[model samples]
Structures are given as C-alpha cells and as structure tokens.
Target: MYEKVINASYDPIFIADKDGYGIKMNEAYTRVTGITEDQLIGRHLKDVVKDGIISESVSLKVLKEKKQVTIIQHVNGKELLVTGNPIFDDKGNVSHIVTNLRNISALKSLEAELSRTKELANKYLQEIKIYQKKEDMISHEGVIANSRQMLNVINLVQKITPFNSTVLLLGESGVGKEVIANLIQKWSTRSNKPFIKVNCAAIPKELIESELFGYEKGAFTGADSRGRPGLFEQAHTGTIFLDEIGEMPLQLQGKLLRVLQEFEVTRIGGRRTIKIDVRVISATNKDLESLVKRGEFREDLYYRLNIIPIKIPPLRKRQEDIPLLANYFLDQANQKYHLNKQLTDDALLAMKAYAWPGNVREMQNLIERLVITTEADDITASHLPFSNQTAFVPQPIQKKMKEVLQDIEREMILKAISEYKTTRKAAEVLGISQSALVKKMQRLGI
Candidate 1:
C-alpha cells in the first residue's frame, strides 16, 4: 500500500543522500526532471536540477533538522513544489533527504479552465452592471486619502477608470498595490469581464507557463484529467492583473512577452494557439531598469506593458495624503463600531511626520489599531504611535553640472561637521591644513 501510494502520487518523489546524491526517484520525477531512475541514482541531486539554485545553508538544515522543507523551484520553464525531508539512521541522525517534486504547471491549467467557467457565469449574471462593479470592487467607498500624492493617485484612477487602456501601478510593498489594481478594474470597460489576478512572484517558475497559458491533459504527467485553459483564455475579453511581474522567470518572460505582443496564447502539448482579447495590466515594485540592464527582464516586454504607467507614489513621497486616508478610515470605523471616530490635530501631525516604509498599507494597519484602542473621538498626539518625527524623504533628482557641484559641496560640509563638534573640528576633520580648508570653504561659498 505504501509503495502504491508513492507510485500513484502526482508529485515527483526523490530520495537523496546527505551529500546531495540521488538514491531513488519516482516515475513522476523522471517525467519532469528528464532523468530516468537509473540515470538519477547515485547522481548529484543538485546537479541534475540546476533550476533549484539552492544555498549551502538549505542543504545543511535539511541534514541537521531531520525534518521536511518545501521550495518553489523554476527550472527551464517549469514550476514545481519540491518538498525535501531528512531520512534518519538507527542513531536518529539524518542520512538522506527524501524529496517530493509536484509539477503544478498543470494545476495552473486547471485554474484557467476554472476561470473560463467564472466568465461564463459572468455572462449569465443578473444586474450585470451592479454585479460587475461588485466583482471588480470598483467603489472607493472604503479607501481614504488626505495627501496630495494620494489625491493625485485617486485623481489618476478616476481619470483612467473611464478609459479602456492597460494600467501599470508601480510602488513598494505594503503600499496597497492590489487596492489600486481592484479600483482600476472595477471602473474599467471590462468590469463585466473577469478581473483575474496572477501574482508572478507567488507562482513557481516552471509552472508560470501553465499559470499564464494552461496545458492539455497528458501534456505532461500529473496534469489534470481534462486539459485546462490558460489564464489568457479564462480572461477572454476581460482583464488580467500580472502582479510582481519582475519575479517571472526569464524563459516564461518570453512567453508572457509573446502574449502581450500578439494578444494570443498556446497551451502546452496542444496543437493550436488560442487568440485572446483580454486587457493586460501589470504591477510591480521592483527595479525593472536594473533587471533589464542585468539581462534579467526582457526590455521589449517592459516597453510593451508600460504603456499606461500609473506611478502610485509611495506614502513617504506623498505625505500630504495621510490625513484624508485616515479620515476615510475613521468614517469606516464609525459605521462599523457605531462610535464617532476622531483624531486630534497633534495626533494627525504625528502620523504625518513618521517614515512609512510600508506605505499606505502600513498606514492603514496603524490607523485600524488607533481606531480600536483610543477612547476619544478627537485623538491627541499622545494617542498617536510613532518611533520618531520625520517628514518624507526627498526624491533623487538628476541635475546638471551646477547642482552636482553644490551637492558635492553640501555632502562634504555635512560629513565634516558631523565628524567634528565645531567648525574648527570640522576643518580638522577634512584632513587639510585649517587654512586650506578655510580657503576651499570660502571658494565653494559653503
């Protein structure tokens, strides 16, 4: 029965020695890894699977813990959930790692099929407008913004909501990227269509293809019984939000780039390519420029999706919007808690001064806490929570010769002053004779 379970499992199973040598592999492993049982046996496990790109600490832990660990692996163009477990000897020490690799590329195919069903359901729904608006979460009823930057974002979304163009939201994590994405879809022409979301970072690399463009049954072993539709097919005439687009593996980047260019997709092990009319919108908080320069992300793909770039300025950059967002939350709390929620001027000021590394999302969580904890409607500065009082950081500007010289001078003076207690100490800190430092300082007009 145990052997039957192992053989019947859909996921690939591998047993490797402590040093990373494969001792045994299941049939599923052969189908995905392309390494036959005989060939895999006694081979270096990591060598056979280069896509894993594991660190030394991982191997050590697997051996030491005598426990199990799961890793999301992207090899070639396939995605797999590889779970490794330590095998113990008579002394209870870990001897080998019995790992299971489940190829979920096919699962994504299933998701695509499921998505089509969702679209068909949409077509038959009553009050299509109301249902679509709710489905896409279009209303800004719950969102709150006080700062000019947040206001600008609200304004931009309001502007684009009436249009049918592809939208790209750029910002850091915990910045309500999804909130903005939902708002865009809720107000777009395809609101009646499925607002399918695909997180590029969450999906396994190998499975990204199937997740994006599904696969046919028997296209590969462990696939669903019925060949499934891809996300493109599921989102036909609808909208698909590709979040964390930067984490997509390079090989799949080509596939995604192709879909964006041709507006079509083909399934794995399928004969014909399927044409799709879905509007493609993507969001990312990554340094895509650096990725492109390093040959990590495709440049062509970047230009294609960046058509309607909506820069969701980080909360730190747009500090002015915090109060509005806070009030929106307070109104929400009033409705929920049946209490008149309010904040004092000092409290509001304190919130405005803190550095929001997590952005709007972080702010939201903090406000919720304040709403639940505070007693007074008019919350005071003492009621507010913050580690320090600092305004937003200034964005970097690429200036020409004059600004560069001034920046250089400012940095030197600041560093010198900081290192020393006074101007004399600062002069000494520069390491030049005091007279030379004074002369240079005068010349630079510092």
Candidate 2:
C-alpha cells in the first residue's frame, strides 16, 4: 500500500540506500528526469551525476552529511527544487535517503509576472494622480464673459496662445486676471508642461529673488539643506505666471529682465547659469506705465512684457455680462452649499444695476453669502447687501443725469481706493488729480 501510494504521488520521489545507490523510485521520478524506473532504481547517485543523467544529487549530500538537505537542481533544461532526508535504522545508522523533487519553472515565471503587474499598477496610479492635479489646476468654469470688450480680450488671448511671447494682463483687482492667465496656459502649445504661478505682491521682498531664481545649499539663513529649484527652473519648457508684477521690488526687476531677455537664470548662491525655455505671463491691477514714469519700475522690462497686452474689462465696463456671470455664480453657490436656489427677476435686475466694486470676485462672494443667509429658496432684491436702496434696483422716478453720473463717479473713486494702496495711486488709476480725488472722496462720504 505504501509503495502504491508513493508511486501514485505527483511529486518525483526517490529512495537511496545507505551505500548511495537508488533502491526505489516512483514513476514520477522517471517522468521528471526522462530516466525509466528500471534504469534509475539501481543507479548510484554519484554515477548519475558523472554520467550527466542528473545534475548534483541532494541525496548524496544527505548521505555524506547524515542529515536533511535542500538544493536546486537543473535537469533537461528545467529547474527543480530537490529536498533530501536521511532515514535511520534501530542502531541510529542511516538506512536510506528519501528525496523529493518539484519543478519550479512555472512558479518562478508566475512570480516574475506578478512583480511586473504590480509595477504597471503603480505607474498607472501615478499617472492618475498627475492627471487629477492637472484637472484641478485648469478647471475654471466661473470665467464667463459675454460682453464685447471681454470677447475681444478672449479673442486676443486665443490669437497669442500659439506663439511664445510675454503677455501682460492689465485689469482692475477682482477682474479675473489670474483666470485669464490660467486660460492662456491651458490653451497654449505647452499645455502638457508645467504651469507655475508666482504672486510677486504676496511673496516677501527679501525672499523674492531666491524664490524666482532658486538657490544652492546654504544660500541664506533658513534655506533648505538640500538646495531647491525656484519657480523659473520649475517652469522650464512651460509657462510661469507673475501675478501682481507691479509689486516686485525695483532691485529684482533687473534680474527678472535678464531672465526675460536671455532665457537663463542663475541660482542665488551658485555661480553657474542654467538656460531655460519658458513663456512668461504677468498680470497687475496697477499702471505699469505710470510706475515706469515714477521710476518705480524698469522701462526695458515694461516694453518686453507689454509685447502682448490683454486688458480684462472691469465689471462696470462689462455690465452686459452681469446676468450670465451672476447666474453662473449662483449655480456654483447652490452646488457648493448643497442647496437648490433660484434668482428672482428683481434679484437679477438688482445685480445688473449695482456697480460691482470688487468685480467678479465680489459678485461670487455676494452670491455665496445670499445662498447661505437667505431663508427662502428664491433670492430677491431685498437679499442683496448694499447700503444704498437705489444700488439694488432702479426706481420708477429716475434721478437726473447729473445725479446718476455723480453716483457712478462715487463708485469708481471708492473702487479705485480699494484697489490701490494710497490716494495718489488711486487718483492716478481714476485719471483724476490728487486734490480733486481727495475733494471727491470727502463730498461722497467715502
């Protein structure tokens, strides 16, 4: 029964006597080695290796060591795992050695295939992450402009997208200059490359140089230990948006001009200059021409940047686009806050009437505020947040043209103040003398 069970086993099995001669072998052993049972049963283990019938025998090693052994054996161009164990008699002497062999070629192949599959899965996951990041960066559904002025700006953006030229986006604060810059990058030929944004006004003046040009190790105090690449290096073969370019210090303007002219940057502490291929897009609410006249900005840099100037019209100038922009913002607010809200005709009229001092950004904020604060599902003129009643909806008895013009003038002066740092700057932006602006501010109760 034991012999029959051994012969029926799937794994190759061999029994060798203490003298190292094969005394018994299963049919599986003959099938694996291509040696018949008659030829294998009485063959010495060392004689099989000498005759090249089998590779190194584990049974011979077990007999010599008087212990169990495991070895890899190559036979007939196939890999096999061979394990051998010595059986002892009553006097503690070796009686025979039992050996088992298993073909591991298919198992090894399966293992290699599994490793390759895991690597491919990891690569796909990384690609998904990259695509998700790009989606987040480029998605801007709120930038809707139907006004002729805005359409012209969009047209100019489309025309210049195919070429690599410096673009200077001039607009009032909250007029969506950043949104336009992102659109240019998304539509450009280098859309697949990186789009790096740097707010010159937001970054500290002391650190702006290193942040734009990168730094080697120990470049300055509190610097990264391993060194770091700056925005210019990161934007190689892509686009770098310099938001609020008017705020960059005069000292760093020369360095920036050099980069724009030579297409190269030198690290803050390193001596070597690295070449880069990048498109520059700069935006600002301030008047760069006035800045140059005041010696606050570089004239050479201004000409280089103004190669492709795109002026995004303020909300007041594009009142025709208010309904579309308002509805879009309203929908966004409802979706963001998980509410179902609609704008009444009165509410839409009120939004169109009001001079959006904060422009699109202010409109979006007002919509979100109304969506959250209003008790009813329908937003009416009463839900608007304006101090002046006439600002929300036009009255049946219209004011004189002079009075209407004064109201528009008041709103512009206030907006200019909110957009600029000082009264002089605000006056320059409003195209009025400083004394006249101050007098107007006092009369309007601003």
Candidate 3:
C-alpha cells in the first residue's frame, strides 16, 4: 500500500538507504527519466552519477550533509528540480533519503510569457500618452488658445488631469474659466462619470447649503417628499465645478471644508453620512486672498481648493489672438445663422485696436450679433460700434490708411455728440459746421 501510494504521485521519486544505495523507486521515475528499474534499484547514487544517467545526485549530498538537499539535475536532455529529504533512525542516524523530482521547463516558458506581456503593456501605455497629447493640442469646445499664456495654461491642464487634486481657476469674468474646467473634466479618467456645475452667486444664500449637501424628506417647507440628492451627491465618482466660488456663504463654507477633509457629507436633516469620490474644480473672478484677509472667506477652504491654480489671461493682454478668435466666432456665427457676413481688414484692425473689456465672452456675443444684424456682405470699420475716440486711435502705416482715418474721425464726432447733447453743440466742439458733421455721419453710416 505504501509503494502504491508513493507511485500515485506525478513527480518521480527515489528512496535510498543510509549509505546512499538506491532501495526502491516509483513508477513515475521510470516513466519520466526513461531509466529501467534495474539501473537504479540496487545501485549507489554516486555510481548513477558516474554512469551519466544524471548529472548530479541529491541523495548522495543528503547522506554526506546529513540533511535535506536540492539541485537542478540534467537527465536525458531534460532539467529536473530534485530535492532529497533524509529520514533519521531512532539513534539519529540517517535511515533513508527520499528524492522528489519535477520538470521546470514549463515554468520557465510561463515566466518568459509574463515578461513579454509586461513589455506590451508598457508599450501600450506610452502610445496612449502620445495620443492624449495630440488630442489636447487640438481645440475643443470653442477653445482657441493661440497666445503663449493660454498655451501654457492648456499644457498645465493636461499634466494635472490625471490626478484628483483640486483646481482653482482665477481670471476676469468672461475669460473662459468655465471652458477650462470643462476641458479638465473631458480629459480626465472620470470623463464618463457625472459632471455637476453650480453657480454659487446664482443661488440664494438661504438655499445654498441644501443645494450642495442635500436634505432629508420634509426637512424644510416646500421640500420634496421623497427628498433629493444635491449636486455633490449627483456628481459622485466624477467632477463638480463650483462657478463663482467666492460668492459662497461664509457659514456654509465650513461644511464645504468638512466635506473636502472627510470625503463625506451629512444631509441637512439626517445624521448618517454618505461617502463620495469627487474631484473639485472652482472658478472665481473675485480676489480670494483679499476676501480671506477681510474674513469674508474661509482661509482653510481657500488653500484646499487652490492646490493647483490656473489664471487665464484676459483678452486685452493677448491681443494677438483677437484676430483668430474673431474669425473663429465669425465662422461659427455664420454657420449657425446661415449668413455670409465677412469682416474686412479695417474691421479686424479696429477690433484688435479696441480693448475687449469683457474678454472672450463679449467677443463671441458681439460677433454673433454682427452676423445677425449687419445687412451688407462685408462689415467694414465704419460698421463697428466702438464709439470711444481713444479706443479708435489711428495706427501708423496701415494698408487701409484712409479707412482707418475715417474710423478715427467718426469715433471723435460720435464722442463729441455723446458729450454735447445737440448736433450744433457737437459740431462747435469739433470745430466743424453742423452740415459737414451730419454729412460725414451719414457717409460713415454712424
């Protein structure tokens, strides 16, 4: 029964006496090593090694060392992992040594396959990074960042999108801070997750808390009977954009700070907390540092949200991008309204000269308005509405010098008329006759 049990094992087994003479062998030994029973049953292990049946003898090492031994033995062009464990008699003398052998070629093949798989995985990761970089360079969602400042901003957005850190966007109103937030979400790993946008300034102070952290059923008057999840809850496992974050209430800012610290929120009328995984992005035109100094904003929350700050440059500073933006908006408006309105060189030059106080938003709206309202195919400098004389100052050495001068004259006459109520008073201020003023106004389509 013991011999049958030992023969049942898949691995080859050999039993040797104390002096290292082989005493018995399992059927697997003959089947795996292709050695006949007579070759090893009565032979000493050292003689087996000398016969070249095996390159080494683990049983002989076990007898010499008086302990277990292991080695790789080459037999019939195959590698065997052989381990010999000694059995001691009552007198602590070696009674026998039992050796077990297993083939290791398949394990080596599996290790090679795993190494190739790791290499392929790394190659795919590098390729994905290159593809993502190219995608970031192409504009999305009306974002045309041609200036060096805006390009740097885009690059920073790309670098930080992989992380879950909070981002604070600082810029003047209409500088497209919201657009940058959208791009951040679009490029992130959570792109398929929910995206919730809330304007802190738009909501009333009394309801802002409930609008952010949710409430239980019947928590307040006019509350829904079944209760509702707030914007933060709805944005779980995704991103939340807090627009105009500076306008958030002071009392509620403490709760927001808690949420940021704990990654959990308690409803207005419930004690239970709901855990969330959300990436926060905030935007504010107001100066948060000034607000903090005045004690109007929470200092801790400000620092928490400002982990990564991106300040978008206003339109006036990046005037070089004005022409590109103007043409882009023009094309967009034309496509939407199915109109063929085109801006002439004088019109573009005048636009670039004027300071766009309202930034990209104002430019986009104005272009759409021009496309809809202008009747002629070509919109010239005379058709522009920048009526301030200082803003329409003539530039030196221009292709359309005559048109530029005419625009300046029109701006001056309009300013004078706006300051002095009557046309007669405006003409006197301009040192021109009323008839000449009116004729020039008509000619310039003022």
Candidate 4:
C-alpha cells in the first residue's frame, strides 16, 4: 500500500537508505529528474545531480538532526520542491531517509506571475513616490514620440505600465518596438533588475533554444564556452523582451510556453532548474492567431502571451504626425552634425505626400539625408530622393510591374545591407525600423 501510494502520487516520491543510496523512487521522480531508476538505484544521492543538495551531508543532517530539509531544484527543465526527512527503523534509529519531491513547475510559474505582478505594483508605488517628490517623470529621448499615433501608443503604455500583463506590440517596419519595451522597463518595478532582449528571428534555428533558455555544457555541439546564461536566466529579476517571437521555430515554441507556464527554466544537459522573476513582453509582426489555427503555433502559448496586445500603426496610417516627427528628427540631425536646418514646404510636402513605408524612422533618415547631402537649411523637393519625377507614375503602366516591385524591394534591401551591413540596416533603408523589420521578416516568413 505504501509503495502503491508512492507510485500513484504525482509528486516525485523516493526512498533513500541511511547510507544515502536510493532504495526506491517512483516513475514521477524519474520523469521529473530524467534520471532513470536503473542508473540511480545503487548510486549515492550526490550522483543524482551535481547541484542537488541531497548529498551525504543532507542525508546525515536529516538522520542525525531529526529535521526536515526542504530545497528547490531544477531538473530536466522543471522546478522541483524536495523535502527530505529521516525515516526511523524498528530500533528507533534512522534506517531509511525518505525524500518527497513535488514538481513545482506549476508553483514556480505562479510565483513568477506573482513576482511580475508585485514588480509592477512596486513600480507604480515608486512612480508615485517620484511624482510626489519631483513633480514629473521624464521620458527618455530614444523612447519618446509625439507623433499623434505614437502619442496614443505612449498614453496606452503609461496606462499599462503599472501592470504585469504581457504586452504584444505590433506594427509595420521602422516603428521602435524595442524602444517601447525599454519604456515599459523604465516604468516597471523590476527596473533595477536586468532587462534582456532576445530576437527569436535573429538566432539561427539550431541555437535559438540555447540562446533564449541556455544549455548545459556538453548538451550539444558548439555549446557556450562556460555554459553561458540564457535570455530567460539573465533576465532573472527583470524583463525579457522577446522580439520577433513569431519566428521562433515550432519545436522551441512548446519549450518557451513551458517557461512562461512554469516560471522556471531548465538548462539543456544540466539538472538544476533555476527560478526566475521575469516579466515576458513579446512582440511580433506575425499573425499568431492564423498560425495557431493552421497548427503552426501553439494555442496555449498564444493565449498566454495575448494577455495584452498593443498595436503600433504603420507610419503611413498615422500621416498627420509626419511634420512633427520630421522636425524632431531634423533637430537631432542638427545636434549631431552641427548643420542648421529647415524643411521647405515643397520638401516637407513631398515627404508628407510620399507613402512612408518605413514610417517615422524612414522620415528621420530622409531628414538626415537632406541635412548632409544638401548645402542649405531649407531643403526643397529637389533634395528629396523619393520625389523624383518618375516616382509618381504607377508601375503597372511599365513593363513587368510585378518584377519591378521585386526589383525595387531587392535593391532597397541590398542598399540597406550595404549601408548598414545588416538586416537591421536593410529595414532602415526600406523606411521601417529594426523591430518593424523583424515584423516584415515574420510576415515574409523569412
């Protein structure tokens, strides 16, 4: 009956003799630890896992001191809560020591959720304190925008900053998603903790898992030099911004979902599970709902992340803000290049009239180009590149219109690559920004 109960219990149940040898362990324990019964049967508890404290010392302490020792551990990507105590024999001596392990993956996830909640609460309290004392909360420059669309986005951000809910920022290329995430962190209670960003699309398919969640040394070929920390682990007490999360390979999606659910990360090839207090704010340009229905993305993970969704309208959608955005960028250009600047009505109109595929970021570069390439503060239509006389003509009237679009896109990408030496650069060339580029890549499934 006792053996049956141990076997039936969902908690990893095991019996270790006074000598610290495992006398028995149920299937749950084996599954959670990934240490088979065959290997651990006659072995000492220390051999179970390197970081596990179930060594002879812990066993001895429990046997001699007659007290319970509870420890949290990581095993096979799961968090485990283990309680060890001495089991006395008929002679009233410690003959066997029993260890009750509860797979705390669920508990750890809850704790992580609670930690994020508490962090937001603390951030609000701190913000209130700062407001009460200083009378203002300064917005960081790289992170602020007065573009009417961006203004609305910022207002929403302020409203949501006090909560730990997962935020998914969506938009066309060039809008600064990372900047928004940084703003979120700046207002978060976990501001003092690390803020790690992982570009799911940036990492090679083979390395994405190890990069985001880390791996045990020798877990796979080309592992990190010292088993480096993963994005989730590095974020520890702070936030992890998962950029282009839609590009994350299907295989790793389940693992990421587990991390979100369990609030603990198990390193590859390593037995210890580490608890984390990370607020996950994921951004992607991909339509996850479509992916879910198509069976390409996990429904559970989507539901978890879709807790809060904020869409960043593409630059073209918010054309009213172009004038302000251009002027602000011109100011930045002047400060950086020491060039006095002004945009002529025709020049500004041309820019305003141009369908800004790249958004605010594209306009910024256009201003900078007008600043450096032109010789005057007053940049006219002639200074603008897209305002070329031929640009206004519809491509369908030309031969191979479809081909022309591809060629245009290809040329722009290549030019950006040549200029920026990266996809991030190419995205900039197309008038969208980096995170926006990430979205395009996800959309293109690139």
State every prediction's TM-score relative to the real structure.
0.54, 0.58, 0.58, 0.56
- At residue 56, give the lDDT of candidate 4: 29
Residue-by-residue lDDT tens digits, candidate 4, 1-446? 98898889887777878877777889887777786777667777667555453332345457667768877766667767778888777988788878777778988788999999999999999999988543222234455454556777878888888777788877666777777888888987878889888888888998887888888777887776578778899998889999998888899889898889889999888888899888989888777888899998889988888888888876645545666677778888988998888877666656555556566678877788778888766888777887664433444633266544543443344334545778766776688888877665554323
Candidate 2 residue runs with Cα over 4 Å from true position: 1-142, 390-446
Which sequence of candidate numbers ranks them by TM-score, best first?
3, 2, 4, 1
So what's the TM-score on candidate 4? Answer: 0.56
Per-residue alpha-carbon lDDT of model 3 for 1-446, expressed as tens digits?
A: 98988889888899999988999898898887887888898998889999998899998899999989999988887778989999999999999999998876666777789999999999999999899765545455457877788888889988999999999999998999999999999999999999999999999999999999999998988988888788899999999999999999999999999999999989888889999999999999989999999999999999999999999987866766788889889999999988889998768767765656678999899889989988999987777777234564554532167766665675576566656868899999999999999998887655
Candidate 2's displacement at residue 334, Å, is 0.8
**Runs of candidate 3 exceeding 4 Å displacement:** 1-138, 387-446
Candidate 3: residue 51 Cα off by (Å): 64
lDDT rank order: 3, 2, 4, 1
lDDT of each: 0.72, 0.85, 0.86, 0.74
Q: How far off is residue 46 in model 1, in Å?
A: 99
**Candidate 1: worst-modelled 10 consecutive residues by lDDT:** 387-396
Backbone N/Cα/C clashes per model? 15, 0, 0, 9
lDDT of 4: 0.74
lDDT of 2: 0.85
Off by over 4 Å in 4: 1-144, 389-446
